[model samples]
Target: MNDIRLYAIGEVARRTGLSVSAIRFYSDEGIVAPADVTAAGHRLYDVHAIARLEFVGTLRELDAGLDDIRRLLEGRVTLSDLATAHLSRLDDQARRIRSRRAVLRTIARQHTEAEQVILMHKLAGMSDDERDRLFDDFWNEISEGLEVSPEFLGLMRNGRLVLPDEPATEQLEAWIELANLLQDAGFRREVKEALHETFSSPGAAIMTSTEMVGVFERGGAILVRAQEAQRSGAPADSPLGREIAGLYSAHMGEITEIPDSPEYRAKLAADVLGIEQMYLESLEEAATSTDPYTRYQSLVAIIDGTAREAAEFMPFAWLSSALKAVASLKDS
Candidate 1:
C-alpha cells in the first residue's frame, strides 16, 4: 500500500504536503472529491486529486472565489480571461484607494470629517462629459453676443478633463484637487477674465479659438524642449539638429510673428522646443509615475493647447451669437 500511488487521507496529506484539515475542507467545498473509498470506509485520493488541490490553493491565494475556482476547474473560463478580470478588479481597488487617500488628506488638513467629505466631492475629477457640460453651461451664461467658431468649440471640448474612472490613489487625489481648483469661484472668474483679454484687444484680431489654442500649445512645447536640451549640454544655438527643435520652430511661428528668418526661426524654435520636450516627457511619464499632480499636468497640457483659441473669444460676448453652440458654459 505504501508503494502504491493511491493513498488514504493521512497518506495523501503526507505525500501531497497538505494538512489533513485542508484536505477535508477542499473535500467539503466540492473542490476535490475523494477517490474510491477504502473497504474500511477511509477517504482515499487518486493522483489527479493531488494536482487539483494544488491548483485550487493557487487560485485561492490569487483572490478567486470558490465559485470561480469551480468554474475554472470545469474549464468554463480561459486562463487569459481569468487573469484579465483579476487585474481589472485590482485596478479598480487601487483607484478606490487613491480616492480614499485624497479624502483622508483633506480630512487631515481640515481636521473634520464633514469638511473633508465636502472638500473631497469638489476635488474629485469629473468625467469628460461632466466637464463639457460645465463649460457648455458657462458659455450659455456669459457668452451673449460672442462670435465663437466651430473649431473653437472643438478645442474646448478636447481640453475637457477625462480622468480614468478607476484611477490610482494618487490620481484620485489629483482629481479631487483639480476639481476643487476649477470649482473655486475666484479661480474660475480669473480664468474667465484672463480669457477675456485675448478677444478684447481690438476688432478683427485675425484668429479663432482653435488657431490661438494651437499656437500657444505649439509654442509652449518648443519652449519646454529648448529649456531641457539647453540644460543637457545642448547650446541654445545647437544647429536645430534634433527634430524636436525643428518641429517646434516650424509649427510655433506658423501662426505668430516670431520672424521667418532661418537663424531667428532656429533660435525661437530651440528655445520653445526645449519647453515642449520637457512638457511632453511629463505627459508620457504620467501613466506610471505616482505623482499627485497628474491631473494638473494633463490640464496644463490641454490648456496650453487651447490658449490661442481661448484668446480669440476672450473679447466679445455680446456682438453676435454665430458661435452660440460654443457660447454656452455653466459657472462652477
Candidate 2:
C-alpha cells in the first residue's frame, strides 16, 4: 500500500471534475477517506481512493445525499439498490415537472385573470381520483329520479371526461367549461325537468327501449335530407321542407300512437320546445364530440321540427296566438 503511486486532491479534482473542497468534505464526512497522509500532513489518494472519489462524484451528480453516499461507501447499501431508488425518485420528479409545465402553458393562453386563477385552482390542485369523483357526482344528480336505460347508465359511468396527463390548452378549457356547466343550478334543474318529462310521457317506455334505436336511425335519415334542403337554401316552409316535415310528423304519429291533428301536434311541439334550451346547453357542453350528445339532440330536434311544421299549417291567427300561449305555459 505504501509503495503504490498516489495523486493529490488537486489531481483527483482535475481528473474527476469535482472541486478540491468537495473531495475534502467527502473525506471529512468519511464518504471517501484519504489513502494516506504525507509526512508534511497533506492528504493523498491511492488508485482505490481515486476510483472511490470518482464514484462519489457520479453519485453527487445524481443528487444522492451525504448519508446515502456514506452508506454506499460503507457497504451498507449496494450500488444497484441505490440506483434503483434514485431512478424511482427521478421518475416522480419528472412527472411533477411535466404537470407544472402543462399548468403554465394553460395559464399563458388564458384570456382573463379570473379564468387563469380559476383554472389554476381547479386543475393544478386536482388529482385523478378527484376528477373522477366530480363526474360521478354530477351524473348521480342528473340521473336522480329518472328511469334511464341500463345501457344509458353504463355509458354515463364509463364515458369519462378525462384530462390527459399533460393536458393541452383546449383540453384544459374544455374541462373548465364542463365543470362549470355541471355545477350550474339552473342548468341542472332544466336538465332534470327535461329528463323527467321525457321518461314520464306516454311514449316514454317506447323511447327507452332498444326499439328507440330504429326511431333514431329513421330520424337521422330525415335530418340528413333536411340538412341537404337547408344547404340548398330551401325556406322552412318550402316544398322540400314540407316533405321532410311530413315524413317527420308521420314518424312521430306512428311512434306515439297520437293523431297528427293540429291540436295534438301543437301540444307535442309545446312539450318538445319547452326542453329546447336545456338540449342546446347540453350540446354546448359536448361540443367537441359528435357522439356525446347528438343522439339526444336528434330526438329533440325531430319532435320540435315536426310540431312547428304542423303549427305552420294552422290558421294564421290561431298558429301565432294559440301556440305562443301553450309554449309559454309549458316552458314555465
Candidate 3:
C-alpha cells in the first residue's frame, strides 16, 4: 500500500475526462470504490481503481446504465461480456432511431395534417408480415374463380409490395397509395370484372396446351411488329396499321375457330378497344401521382403505348361476337 501511488477524486476526474461530481456519484454508488481514505479525510484511488474508473467512464460514454456499470465493476459480469451485450443494445437502439427518422422525414414532407397523420399511422402500425398478408388477401379476392396460370400466379405473388424497414419517402408514399388502392371496393370490383371478362371470353380457351404455345409465340411476334410500326410512326388507319390489325384478327380467328371476315374483324376490333380502354383507365387512376419517384407513369406509358399500337390493327369486337358466333354455329 505504501509503494502504490494514489489519485484524489479531482485528479481522477481530470485524468478520465469525467466531472468530480460524477466520480463522487460512482464512488457513493459503489461503482468504483476508492482504494483508501487519507488521515486528513480525502478519498484516494489506487492505480487499479483509476484504470477501473477509466473503463467505467468509457462505458458511460457508450450509454451504459449505472446498474450495468456496477455489475461490470463488481465482477458479476466480465468486461468483454458486458461490452458485447451493450454493443447489441446500442445496435438495436440505432435501428429504432433510424426507423423513426425515416417516418419523421415522411411526415415532414406531407402537405396536409391529415396526410401526415395517416402516413404516420400506416407506417408505424404495419409490420412486414401484415403488409404481406394484405397483398395475399387482395390477390386471393381478385383471382377467385379465375383460371390464372401457375407461372403467372407465381409472378403476381412474387411481386408483392412491401416497404423496407427504413423506407425512403417516395417508397413509403407509393406503398401507402398501393394499400389504399387495394382497400378500394370499386377498384377491386373493376379489376375483378376485367379478369372475369378476359378469362371467360371466347378466345380464353386459346390458352390450351398446344394452342397456348402457338398463341404466346404469335402474340410475341405481333407485339414486336406493332412496336416496330409504332417506332416508325405509322398512322393507326394506315396500311401499316391494317397489317398490325390483321395480325391480331388472324390470331383471334385461330383462337375462336371463326372465319376472319370483315364483320368478324370489326367486332374483334371493338372488343380489343374495350379491353384497351379498361386497362388505360385503370392505369391512369392507379398512377395519378405527381411524385417523380412514383414509377407509375413510366409503367402506364409503356402499357398504354403497347395497347395503342395493337389497336392500330382495328380488330374491334372480336371476343364477344366470336363467342356468340361460334355458339350459334355449334347450335345450327
Candidate 4:
C-alpha cells in the first residue's frame, strides 16, 4: 500500500489522453472518483483510477451516455452488455443518417416544394405501426365496396412494405415514394376503378375475382423472365421474345380457360397494351404501364428487396409487341 502510485489530475490526463477538465467532469459525475485528497485539498487518482479514466474516455468517444458508463463502472452491467447496448444505439443512429441522406437526395433531385419536403421527411420518419396503417388504408380504400372475397381482400392487405431495420438509401427512397403514392387520390381512384371493372365486368363470371388476383400474383415469375429477355435487347419478333410472348399467351389462356389462338393473342396484346381496353386485363399492364400504378409496383419491388425483378414498361411493351407479331404471323 505504501508503494502504491497515485496520479495527480494532470498526470492522469497525460496518461489517459483525456483533457484535465474532462477528467474533472468524470470525477464530478462519479464515473471515476479520485482515490484520495491531499492535505492541501488536491484530488489524486491511483493507477486503477487512471485506467478507469482511459476506459471512460474510450466509451465517451464511442458516444456512450454517461449514465451507461456509470452503470458499467458500478458493476450493474457487464462490459459486454454495455457494448451490446451501444451497438444498438449506433445502429439506430446510422439508420437515421441514412434516412436523412435519402430525404436530402430526393429533395435535391426533385427540387421539391417546402410542403412536400416536410411531408417526405415525415414519411421517412414514420413509425412501423404508422407505416403498416398507411399500407392497410391503401388496400382498404381500393377494395372497399368491391364484391371480392375476404381471402382476396386479405391477399391485397398482405403485400406489406416492410423496411428493414438497416435499410439502404434506395430502399428508404422507395419507402418514401410508396408512402406518397399510396396517399395519392388519383392513384387510389385508378386502382379502385380497375378492381371494380375486374369484378363487376363480364370477366368476373369467367373467373372469380380471387382467382384472377391469384393469377396475377402467380404470373410474377413469368413476367420476371420476360423482363430478363427484354433487357437483353432482344427485338419483339426475335425468338427469345416470341418464346416469352408464348409463355404469357399460355398463362393468360389458362386463366381465361380459352385456348391460345391468333385472335385471342391479338386481343390479349391489345388489352394489356391499353388499346380499346375497358379495364386492366393483365397485371403486366397494371405494374408496367405509364400510369402511376406502374410506379407503385416498382417501389413495392424496391422495398421488398426484389428491385432486380422490378419490371419497367419497356419489357412489357416489348412483350406486347411480340404478342402482336406472333398473332400477325399466325394469321398470315
Best by lDDT: 4
lDDT of 1: 0.57
- lDDT of every predicted structure (CA atoms): 0.57, 0.62, 0.64, 0.79
Q: What does candidate 2's lDDT look like per residue over 91-181, in tens digits?
A: 7776566556646665677665876566555654567798778767777887887776766565334455555555444444445545555
How do the residues 257-311 of candidate 4 rate in per-residue lDDT, one tens digit apiece?
9977899989878776673132224444554666655667767777877654443
- From the highest lDDT down, the ranking of the candidates is 4, 3, 2, 1
- For candidate 3, the lDDT comes to 0.64
How would you order the candidates by TM-score, starting with the best? 4, 1, 3, 2
Between candidates 2 and 3, the lDDT winner: 3
In model 2, how many backbone clashes occur?
Answer: 0
Clashes of each: 44, 0, 14, 0
Give the clashing residue pairs of candidate 2, or none. none
- Residues 46-112, candidate 3: write the lDDT tens digits: 8788888888888888888998888876779988898899888877676556556646665677664
Which residue segments of model 1 deviate by more than 4 Å?
1-4, 14-17, 38-41, 115-128, 131-158, 165-169, 183-187, 197-199, 203-332
Root-mean-square deviation of each candidate, in angstroms?
12.6, 15.4, 13.7, 8.0
Badly placed stretches (over 4 Å) of model 3 are: 1-3, 39-41, 114-119, 159-177, 184-332
Report the alpha-carbon TM-score of model 1 versus the true structure. 0.61
